[model samples]
Target: MQTQSSFKTTETGTLFLVPTPIGNLDDMTYRAIDTLKSVALIAAEDTRNTQKLLNHFEIETKQISFHEHNTQQRIETLIEKLEAGDDIAQVSDAGMPSISDPGHELVKACIEAGISVVPLPGANAGITALIASGITPQPFTFYGFLPRKGKELTEAVTTLAQKPEALIFYEAPHRLKKTLQALLSTFGVDRKVTLGRELTKKFEEFIRGDLEEVLAWATETELRGEFVMIVAGNPAPDATVSAVATESLSLPEQVEAQIQQGASPNVAIKTVAKANGLKKQVVYNAYHELTE
Candidate 1:
């Protein structure tokens, strides 16, 4: 447990976590600009991208590349600078760092090394989209970007399916359709969902409706830009629905049942794997043995 009284004493150089605009340069906060200008060094995910922002504001601070690929190597250098009383500001390509982006490792390292980490709030795609999504925003789970494939993805979707709060997920355009299909399978086709793309920019658009409709729209439309998916939480099951619908069957048995009901084996595996919090491979091996 550590208590951070930021700015109370400048004995050590602070590590500032500054948020840049997701899009629409004007969304960049005054405080973020000031920090970027004031810091000794700006460690950015992409120096070229950040340089553009810095130039726009006439912030002459120098930047070094710090991204997922070079995080381990760069972290040591950043920490050394912090230890040497050189204040540093860390920014991602856009929005907040460590939110489905780099900087988490550096923050962790700073905490362990007893360095001060100060975060300046600015633009965030998830929260920005959520407020406008017309979905219940409070008590929402921000589950960043879901795993790409296999049991991890299935289990992640399944976990979100059981929660009563709104769910937020980030997805690239290429994978958006597949993720929506997976959600349709787990959360049912009628579950409410909203898609926010190119947020805060001129091309920003929001698609809101049932999962099936949204999935169809996404499939037919020309996909582009990053997406923030705001999905309504699980509705309360009707009391009339049989408890046996859930409790009577074990996990492997459940997979077999879904397969019998015309679900593909892969789909059933994903759904069941998520429901059981087991790996897809584990469920697959068990299901095959059970059938054989």
Candidate 2:
């Protein structure tokens, strides 16, 4: 258990979590700007991008690069500065820090070192899009971004498919069609979906409809901005039946059942692994041991 008094004066300085605007510079809060201006140093996901926001607010605080690539190399330095009583502010190019952005590691370091962390609430693309999405707002899961596409992507989507809560995902313009197609294929065409693009900007738009309808719309339209995909919760019975029907079978029996259903060993292993929420290698080893 840990307690934090953000304003308590101590030898170590505070780590202020500052949120920048997702779009529309007017969204910048007065407190966010003041904290940025008052901090001893600023850790930005992209200094070049953050510089523009700083310029607009007339905040001259110096910023250092602290992105995904350099997170490991930079966390220690940021922690050291905090320990030295130099209050620091961490910001991403847009939105709050550490929500599919860099800053989580630094924040973890600060906590371990007993440095104070003060978070200033501001813009967040997911929540911003959610309120206007016409989808069930509460009891939602914010899955920042999907994997580009591979085994990881498959595993991620498969895991989320079982969730009963509304799903929120961020996707790039280029991959919008493909992701929508994947969602349609996995969740079925009739599933409800809402896509928010160019959020908080001049051309902001939301496409709300069934998966197939939105997917068709995406295929025909020229996707031009960042997207927030809000998918309806799983309807139940389908996921439950598959899971329950397979639970009665032993691991090897489950593997053979899939194989009898025309699945190859690799495919069967992957399927059973995902169904049981076990690692693929674990299923593979057990299946091989039964065969051996």
Candidate whose lDDT is highest: 1
Per-residue C-alpha lDDT of model 2 across residues 33-143, encoded as one tens digit per residue: 899999999999999999998898899999999999999999989988888889999999999999999989888888999999899999999998888888888889999
TM-scores for every predicted model: 0.84, 0.83
Per-residue C-alpha lDDT of model 1 across residues 14-44, encoded as one tens digit per residue: 9999999999999988899899889999999
Give every collision pair in model 1. Answer: none
Reference-based lDDT, each prediction: 0.84, 0.83
Q: What is the lDDT of residue 224 in candidate 2?
A: 94
**Model 1: residues >4 Å from true position, as ranges?**
237-292
Best by TM-score: 1
- Report how far residue 202 has shifted in candidate 1, in Å: 0.7
RMSD per model, one decimal: 5.1, 6.0
Model 2 ranges off by over 4 Å: 237-292
